[model samples]
Target: MARFVAGYFRSGRIPIRGVHLAVVLTFSLLAVTAHAEFPLPNHGESVIVGGDRAYPPYEFIDKDGKPAGYNVDLTKAIAEVMGIRVEFRFGSWSEMRTALQKKKIDILQGISYSEDRSRTLDFSPPHTIVHHAIFARRETRPVRTLEELRGKKVIVFRDGIMHERLKRMGFDRELILTPTPAEALRLLASGKYDYAVVAMLPGMYLIRELHLSNLVPVAKAVVSEQYCYGVLKGNRELLSRFSEGLAILIKTGQYKEIYNKWLGVNEPPRVTKELAIKYGAAILVPLLVILAVTVLWSRTLHKRVEARTAELAQEVAERNRALEELRRHQDKLIQADKMASLGTLVSGVAHEINNPNGLLLLDIPILKRVHDDADEIFEDRFREHGDFMLGGVPYSEMRAEIPRILQEMQDGAQRIKRIVNDLKDFARRDDAGQKELIDVNAAVQTALRLIDPTIRSSTQHFAATYAEGLPPVLGNAQRIEQVVVNLVLNACQALPGVDRGVSLATGFDREQNVVVIQVRDEGVGIAGEHLPQLMDPFFTTKRDTGGTGLGLSVSAGIVKEHGGTLRFESAPETGTTVTLSLPVPAQRG
Candidate 1:
C-alpha cells in the first residue's frame, strides 16, 4: 500500500526537492564557513605553492597561462578555509622540486611520497592515489612490464618517481628523460621513443586535450602510490595546516566535488523520454487503484475508531495507573539484577585468571631453588665442556640470565595476583587496600621492570630521572605501580617510530608539597580540546587501537584515592607530558 501510494504521488511529479535541497545547501554553507576565518601563520602573507607546468588536470597552466587545474582548485578551497594567502608557481617538474628544495616555495601541491624523497621532504597524509602506466603508439607491440622494455627505448618524466624507481630496479638502460608527462606522451606519440611511462590520469587527459590520438596506454597500472603534498623536511607547521584543511574539505564533501570535476568518471546514465512515456501509464493505473482502496479503508477505520473512543479512554486511565506502579518496581529490580550479574562476572573472570597465575606463583620459586642447587654442577660441566646450549642460549649466558628471567617471572606472577585482587575489589565495590609509605622512585622502577620489553620495542631513546630528597607518599605500592605502567605504555604507543623518545622523571614540588612523576613522549601529541576529557570515563582517541577509554579514567581514580592529581599537557607534532602528583603524608607527631 505504501509503495503504491508513493508511486501515485511521484507519478503526478510532486517536487519534494525543496526541503531536502534547502537542508543540504544550509549544511554545505555551514561546513565551509565553520572554519573559514581560521587564522594561519604569517597571516595575509602569500605562501608560494609550487606545481608542474605540463601535468594536465592534476596541476598545469591553462591556455590563458594561469594555474588552473584540479590541484589549483583544491588548493584554493583549502586556502579559503585555512585562511592563508597562496600564490601558484607553475614550472617544469624538476624546477618546482628545486624551488621547494631552496625554500622558495612553501608547498608542493602534488607529489608522490617515496623513501628517497622523504630523506629531504616531509608529506601530508595522501589526498589521492596516482597510478602510472606504460604508454606506446598504436600498432606497436604492447609492453606489460618494465622488463619487456629491456632493449626498447623508454621515456620518463625527469626527477619523477618512475625515474628513481627504474634506477633503483636497474631498469635505467636506454632511458630517455622528458621534462613533463605531457612532453613525454607527446614525444611517444610522435614516434620519438619506443615507449613512455607517465601518470595514467595526466596521460589520458593530455591525449584528449592535445589531440594526441595515436598514443595509447599499453599497460594499466605499472606503479600505484599515494599522491600527497610535500614540504621541506621539518616544516611541520605548514604541513599540519594543509593536512587539517584537507581533512575539513573531505568532511565537508567539497573534496568529492573537486575530485569529480577532474578525476572522477562522472558520466551519468541517461534515461530516454520515449521509455519514460511507455512505462508512465502502467505505473499510474495501479497507483490510482491503490489510492482509492486506501481511502475507503481509512474511512471504515475512522468510524470504527470513533465507536471505541470512550471505552479506550476509560481502559487507558486504568492501565496507566497499573503501568506506573509496575514500572517503578521494574526499575529497582533491573538495577539490582544488573549489579548482581556484573559482580558474578568479575569474580568468575578473576578466579579463572588466578588459576594459571597461581601455578607461576607456586612453581617458579621451586624452579629457582632447583637452579641454585644445580648451579655448581652446571658450572663444572660448563668448565669442562666450554659451554653447551641451554634453552637456546649458551649455559654460561643462561647462568646469569636464568636468575633474572626467573625473578621477572616472580614479579609478573605477583602483579597478576595484584590485578586479580583489584578486579575482585571492583566486583564487591571495595577500593580499600593496605597503604604503605612508598619510595616513589622504587615503585616506578618496579613498574618499569615489568614493562621493559614494551619500552625497548617502542623507542630507542628512553630516559629515567629519579630525583632525590622526595618524601614518601602513603599508598598501595602495587596500585601506584599500576598507574605508572599505564602512563608509560600510553607514552610508548604514542611514538610513531623507534627514533622518537619516551622519558620519565620523578621530582619533589615543595610549593604543592607533593611528589611528582612526569612521563613525556616525543610522539604525535593530543589536541588541546581533548585534555579535559582525557580523564572522563569511556572517552578515548585510541579506540581503533583497542582502547576502552578506561585507562586514564581508572588511573585518575587510583591517583585520587591516594590523594593525588593527574594532568596532561600536549600539542600536535610536539609531544605529551603526563604528570602524576601525590601529596606528602602528614606526620602524626
Candidate 2:
C-alpha cells in the first residue's frame, strides 16, 4: 500500500487522500446511476401477456371475477419496478399455448419448460420448479414410480402437459380426462378412477380445498419441470427485459415476499454456510462503520443532549398530570353515556313491580276467605278420619298454620302495594312536593317494603327498628323516602350472599339537632379509593349488571335539596354503613 502511494507521486498522479476522495465519489455516482436507470421500459405499445385460466398459486381468475393469483401479483410487481406497460389476457391452457404459437399473444406469463417447446418459444430462466405426482385414494397400495401407472385407469387434466406426457408414454388408451386439475382430483377422490396425475402443488392445494381426506400422493415427483415465462423464439428484446426484471426482483427482496405469500409453505429458502457468511459480512461491515461514526457524533453532542433530556423530563411530568385529569373526566363522560336511560329504567321497574304487587294485593284477600270457609270441612275430615294431609301438611298441625300463612301473605301483599306506590311517587318527574315534617320511621318502613323482594333475595337475616318518639325531619316525604330506598337497596345488593345481614334503625340525634336513619350491611364493602367517589354521578361498582352509578348521585341530590347530609363508612370485605341525617325543626330539637 505504501509503495503504491509513492509510485503514484512519482508518476505525477493524485495524492493518496485525493485517491480516497475519488473512490467515494465514484461509489456515490454509481449508486445514483443505478437508482436513475430504473424503471426499465420497452418504449413501445403495452406488452400483451396471456396465462392459463385454471392454474392457481400461479395464474387464475379469482372468485371475485378478477384476474388474480400468485402469478398476477408477481407480474404486477415486476411491471411496476421495470417501468413496463402491460395488459393481461387469460383463457384455456391449450388455447394460450396455441396463441403463443400463432402470434396471437406476445408472451405467456408462465409455462413448463420442455426441450420440444424450446424450438418454438424462448424461455426465461426458471422462476419455480413443478414436480408432477400421482395421487390415489389413501387405502390404495402406494405406487412409487410413474412406470407403475401403466394399464391403470388414470385421471389427468385434459390438454395439460401431463396428458401429452402420458400419451407419449403409451397410457393414452387408459387416461380419463377432466378440464382442470381440481376436477381431476375430485374425480379420483370419488373412487371412479385408479389414480390421478397432476402437478404436486395443485394436487395438494385442491385436496385441502375440496376436503378430500381420502386422497394421498402415492408417487412423489415422478417428473419435475422448470416453470418459466415464455415468448416466441428470437423475440430477444421483450424476453431480455423480463429476464432482467425477474433477476432484479430476486436480487432485491420483493421476489421473496411474493414467493412466500404463495409457495413458502411448501419450500422455505434453505440457509447454507456460504450464504450465511456472505450475508453476515455484507451486513456487519456497514454496521461497524456506522457504529464508529455514531460514537464520534455522540461525543460532540453529549452536553446538548443532557440539557434537552432535563427539559423533556419536566415536560413529561406535566403531561402525565394532565393526562390523569383528562382520563378521570373521560371516564365520567363514558359512564354517563352508558347510563343515559336511567330515568326510563327506574320508571319501568316501578310500573312492572306495581303490576305484580297489585295481583298479590287483590288475590290474597280472596285466598284468606276461601281458607276460612273451607276450615270447617277440613276439621270435620280430621274428626272423621284422624289427621289426614292438607296442603302437604298433616291436618292436626295445619289447623292453626293455614290462618297464620294467609295473614302473612296478606300483610306481605299490602306492604308490596305500599312500596310500589312510594316507588311510583319517586319515579314521577314532577313530584317534588312541599317540604313538611317527615316521620323518618314511616318513610323508611315504606322504602323497605318497596325493596322487599330484593331484600329477601339478597339476605336471610334482615331487620328494621323505629324509635318510639323520634322527632320528624323537615323534608319532602317522597324525596326522603327515595333516598332511603336507594340506600337500603344498595346495601342489600352489596351483600355477597344470602347469609349476609342488613339492618336499618332510626333515632333522634339530640346533640346534633338532627333525625338520623342508618342502614348497615355485612357485605363486600367499598375500597378507600372508591368511597370518595360514592356520590359522584356514574360511579357504581355494579355497572356490569346495569348499575347506573347515578342512584347514589341522585340520592345525594335529594339529600342536599332537603338540607341533609349523606355519609358513608366502609372497608373492603368488612362491611359498609351509610348514615342519613336530616335537620329537625328547632322547636322539636
Candidate 3:
C-alpha cells in the first residue's frame, strides 16, 4: 500500500490496475530507468563532473589528496545510484559552469539555486537549504530598523538575492558586492562592513572553525535558498534519471540521513527572510552608534600616547645637555689645575737652588784670601835671608796653603753639583711613562727632596715616618711622584702662615699588605659640607684666589687608576690629614 501511494505521488495519479496499464507501464519504466545500475551508457564507461577546488566544506581537495566535502559526498551518492564510476575536473566556478554548458562534463554539483541558473542548466531537487545573513563585528549592535541604516554600507555575494532585496528597499547605494563568502566575513570581522549578506551555514562554519568570538550576526536572514546538482540543458535523459533517483532516495529516507550527517541537527525556528530583515535593522542601528563611540575613544588614546612620547624625548634631550656641559667644565678645570701645580713646582725649584748657591757664595771670600797669601809667598821666592827668616817664621808659613784652598773649593763645587743633580732627576719626564713597578717610599722621598726649598722658605719643617720592610707597589713612578707632589703641595697650601708647617709620613697596614702615605698640615680646616665634594672636578672654595680645583681630583684619578684609595680627615679650625693607600706589589703578582 505504501509503494502504491509513493507511485501515485510520483506519477501524479491513483494506482488503478485495470484502467491505466500503459500509465503504470510508463511509471514503472521511469522507476526502472532511475535504478538502471550500469557502468555507463553503452557508448562510454565513465561520467565526468566539474567543480571549483578552492571551495571548502562543499567542493575541495582534502589534505590526504582526495576530493572531500558535502558536494563530494553527494556526487558519490548520485554516481552510485547511476551505477557509473565518476572522474572530476576542477577550475573556476564560472569556467566550470561554462564547460558544463559546452557538454564537457556529465554533471555539476552543489550549486546554489537561482532563476538565472535555470536558464543555463536543468536542476535536480535541492540537496541543501541555506539563507543569506548579515555578518558584522561583535562590537556592532543588532541592526533591527532599516530606517537607521541611512549612512551604513553592506556587502553581498555577487548575483545574490540580497542585491535584489536591498534594491527594493532603496539600499542599493549602500551595497558592496564581494566574490566570495570568506572575503565578506573577513571584512565584517575587521569592522569594514556594517552588514554583510553571506551564506548563513558557511559563515557559521567559519565562525566555529576559526574560534572567532569577536564577530556577530549583525543582521537577520533576508532570504532562504536551496542548492542543487545540475546538468547541461540538452541532457534530458541524464536529468530524467537524476530526478527519478532523487525521488527514490527521498522515499527510502537515505537523503535525510545524508543531509543530517553533513549539516548536523535540524535546528528549530529556522531563519526566514522576514526574520532577517527584522534583525538586520535590529542589529545595525545600535552598531552604528557603538562604532561612533569607539572611533572617538581611539582618537583620544592616540593623542595621549603621542603626548607621552614627546615628553619622554624632551626629558632625554635635557639630560644629555646637562651631561655635556658638566664634561666641558671638568676639562677646563683640569687644565687650570695643571698650570697651578706647575707654578708651585717652579717656586719650589728656585728655593731649592738658592740654599746651595748661597752657601757656595759665603765660602768664596775665604778661598780668595787664602789664595792671595799663597801667591805673595811664591812671588818673594825666599829671596831674603832664607835661613834666618825660616828660624823666625811661624809653622803657619810652612803649611801647604795652596793645596788647602784648592781642596775647600772642590768640596763646595761638588755640593752645588749634587743639589743640581737631584733637581734634574726629579724633573725628568718620560712622556710615555706608563704603569711600572715602583718603590712607594722612594717616589715619596724624591717628591719631598725637590720641595725642600718650599719647606725652608715657609719657615716650616717636614717629618717622615717610614714602615720597615714595606713592599714595592705596581704603578708608574712618574705618576706616583705627581700624586705625592700634589699631596705635599696641598698640605703646604693648607698651612696657616707660621713657623710650624706640615709632616710627611709613610707606612704599611700589615693586615692589608698596603702602602700608605700621609701628609698632615696645621691649617684652617675644611668646612664639613665641602669635604664630600673635595674630589669633585671644578668644585673649589678658592676660585677667587685662582684655585684650579683639580689638585685633589687629579690625585684621586691617579690613585684610582692604580687600584688604590685616597682619603682625608679634617676638623673645623684644627687641621687636615690626607692619606693614600696603594696595593702591595707582591699581591699584584
Instruction: Note the Cα lDDT for every prediction shown.
Output: 0.76, 0.73, 0.63
Top TM-score: which candidate number? 1
Q: What TM-score number comes out for model 2?
A: 0.39
Q: Give the TM-score of candidate 3.
A: 0.36
Candidates' RMSD to native = 22.3, 31.6, 48.9
Q: Quick one: ranking by lDDT, best first?
A: 1, 2, 3
Query: Which candidate, 1 or 2, has the higher lDDT?
Result: 1
Instruction: Rank all candidate structures by their TM-score, best first, as comma-separated numbers.
Output: 1, 2, 3
Off by over 4 Å in 3: 1-44, 52-56, 144-151, 159-173, 266-589
TM-score against native, each model: 0.41, 0.39, 0.36
Best-fitting candidate, measured by lDDT? 1
Q: Please, what are the lDDT tens digits per residue for candidate 3 over residues 1-589?
A: 1123223322424222211232223334434434232223554556787776645666766678778767777677767786757788876566676787777777887665555556666555555555555677777766643444557888765544456556766787898877666666777777686877666566776676766667766654434454566775545466555555565565567765776676644222544544657765664566456545655655575566556656666779766565556545654554444434443453465465667667776777667677677656744655542311121121223234344545657665665554444334333342325777788888988887888787767645668877777788888887888889878877777777856568888998989878999888888889999999998755778776445566676677778778899998998778899889998866533
Model 2, position 579, has a per-residue lDDT of 93
**lDDT head-to-head 1 vs 3, winner:** 1
**Shift of residue 333 alpha carbon in model 2, Å:** 58
